[model samples]
Target: MRERVDKLKEEVCTLFTPSKDMLRRMYLVDEIVHLGIDHLFEKEIETALKDIHESEFASSNLYEVALRFRLLRERGFWVSPDVFQKFKGDDGNFLNELADDPRGLLSLYNAAHLFIHGELELEETISFARNHLESMIRDSVVKGPLADQVKRALRLPLPRTLKRVEMLHYMFEYDQDNGHNPVLLELAKMDFNLLQQVHLKELKEISSAILDDTYDVYAFSSIDECRTLNAAIQGWDDTAISLVPEYLRKFYEIMLSTFREFEDQMPSNKRYLVAFNKAEAAEWPHRNYKPSFSEQVALATETTGVRSLAAGVMLGMSDAATTREAFEWAVTSTDAIISCAKIGRFMNDISGYKVTVDVAIAKINELMEDEWKTTNRARIDNQAVIPVTQRLINLTMAIPLFYGYDSDGFTFGEQLREILENLYVKPMPI
Candidate 1:
């Protein structure tokens, strides 16, 4: 399997040679990404994209242009959305000829999602392309991989969809493509199965969040019990465990023991940062605390679990660059971290039934878009470690998978059961 994977990877790299046409290269890159094997060829992919960028890529064909724009923008290149202006007719609308091509419209529709703030051209592009793509699907104008892709994009475009979740979908669709590369397909399946084994092994060691469940589900009748538990966590000692309710004693032990295990594995001086299990008990006193939208967002940002999870992820990193500074960056309330938390919280509120705000769903969605822009800007501006930055980005991207498109896949596991099965329980057929 290893020899096959290595040979397949070399063949995949050969596809990026300068002799390949720009459109063909772009499509291969997109497939590599969607197939979840891009991580195996990051340097090769980067070199190819840089070469493409230096070539002053341009195209009269709508599909080629849109694909180029999306591919460039997705990699932090500042490709202007105005590149699409040529496709508009004299009346300030997209050309009727463009609408007739569902393939090109689908490309443009998915590309528009990478828009930053005030890019009205891209926004208009979304509306124009979406209408045509939807019409095409309804009219059965597209079939095979394009058909499957357009339907999925209409639900959640490539940018927002989780990579792991999309891997199996793309693998199956790519299998149906007459032009698909056999080497790439084989590599994707092998890589996927290898990763699944690692994930399943790791899943065995991960216990449920007893403390969070205690606070959220197993509510205490006495508010003082909540206070005691919070204080006990702050104390970070087994002695404080006795002060909490009897049922919570085991949770505290598990949490403290877990942190102690983490501390033992780290440098002695840095062990202090391991006790980052702070929880707020103030909300317990007022169960009916109906906060305004702003208040809800602020509270949720703190309680959304991204900060601790990000920090924990950084702490566990074996990278030499994951230094104390990187750990500090993860725990700090930077714009990037705050945006991630807000995105998670807002998505959860929008999808779950626990929403306390009366704001319209559209309004919350708009706020999420603004937050996404902030996060994307932070991705460009932040000078943190590359591994840390990538980790934060991964954390943010995974949020949409669990709480995306007005569906709380986390809470209502049925929606994601098939996805999880594909990811963890089942391996791609060789």
Candidate 2:
């Protein structure tokens, strides 16, 4: 395996074009880098890229210039954005003529995302290039590979998308064209297969440990397995019957189904999962750029933890009653479930000191207000919502007095597990 990879690496290096063909060479280098197999050929790529950048790089066309600038800046080269100065008109904007070139526009679309917050030209370029590229996609004016590439870029631009996800999507999208090097394509396939095996093995070990440990408590069937475990943990806390024999059986079944879902996601880049998960365009873009505290809480209700609680509620009651109460909880805001979900989300941001103990004291005080004895209890206990909601508002809004910014997530998760245990299972002895 190692020998073939070494051979393929050398073959890819040999494909690099020099001097006048430097622009062409950079295109291949960009693909190789984004594919994340560049570590194998890093020294060769660096040497070739530097040579191209130093030798007559400024004389290249718009596509070449944009691609070269993007690749160099991304690789930590100190090239100036002034390289784009030549492309501008007397009006001090990018030339109107440049919008006609799809390849150049695409390169600029990618380059714009690398802006460091204050680069005004780059910011303008993002809006300009996106408009042209998206118009092309919307109008069906372009076809074949370029059109497909446009659509893909619109969804996951180079800078913002996760590297592994990009490599996974591009792995299958990479086709050996008549002029392209087959050796590079073959190397990519081999490396992806190797990486995928590692991902699967790691996930399998995690899946096994989860089933072994949580089989006695609760298991979740309908969501991401990691989140399912979280949901099941909530179920164990939220209900006295979480340990009942029948519930445990359902828990195992749910756990098994969750693992199966993970396996299903194992084979492809998550385009399948994403398709099902994505809300329509009208419903997305989330109404607020930074979601408010209540909005975040409402969003958390859609998560597995909240739905997991709902599942237990529905399981113990008839459909008609469950639906009515669940709707009431959703509309009127069930303070207990809302607080629990908020704690779960914020636990990802918890510190061992303040957020940790604050959560404990607050939860204890909350349980004292109303005995969370039944699913319907929290829904109708209108008084419980005001105090819990107010406390939550204070905690989030007043966090700045201590941290001076939004919350910082820790390397550890759920620091108040004992507090949750007291609230959910049964109260620990004072």
The residue pairs that clash in candidate 2, if any, are 237-424
What's the TM for model 1? 0.87
lDDT of each: 0.75, 0.52
TM-score against truth, every candidate: 0.87, 0.48
Q: Which stretches of candidate 1 lie over 4 Å from their true place?
A: 18-20, 208-210, 218-220, 259-290, 315-329, 354-359, 382-387
lDDT of 2 by residue, 1-430 (tens): 6678778877886776454677677878887876668767766776776787677765647777888877765554545667788889888888888878888888878766655433667767878889988887778777776777677677545543445445554654566245555677778767666655655566556532233213222222222333343444434333523443453455555554554543332334422221222221113333434556556445544342343332233333334344443434433335545544454444333332345476665763343222212221232233223223222222322222222212332322242343223223331111
Give lDDT: candidate 1, residue 317: 62
RMSD (CA, Å), candidate 2 to true, equals: 21.4
Model 1 lDDT tens row, 1-430:
8788888888888787775476777888888998999888777777777777777665888888888887776676667777888988788888888878988888888888888778878777888888888888999999888899899999988776777777878899899889988888999999999889989999998775444435555334655666677778767787887787887787778887777755544445443332232234245335765557676577667666666676777756666758878776776778878888888877776777656566677788788888877666654455446557667877888887877775778777886788888899988899
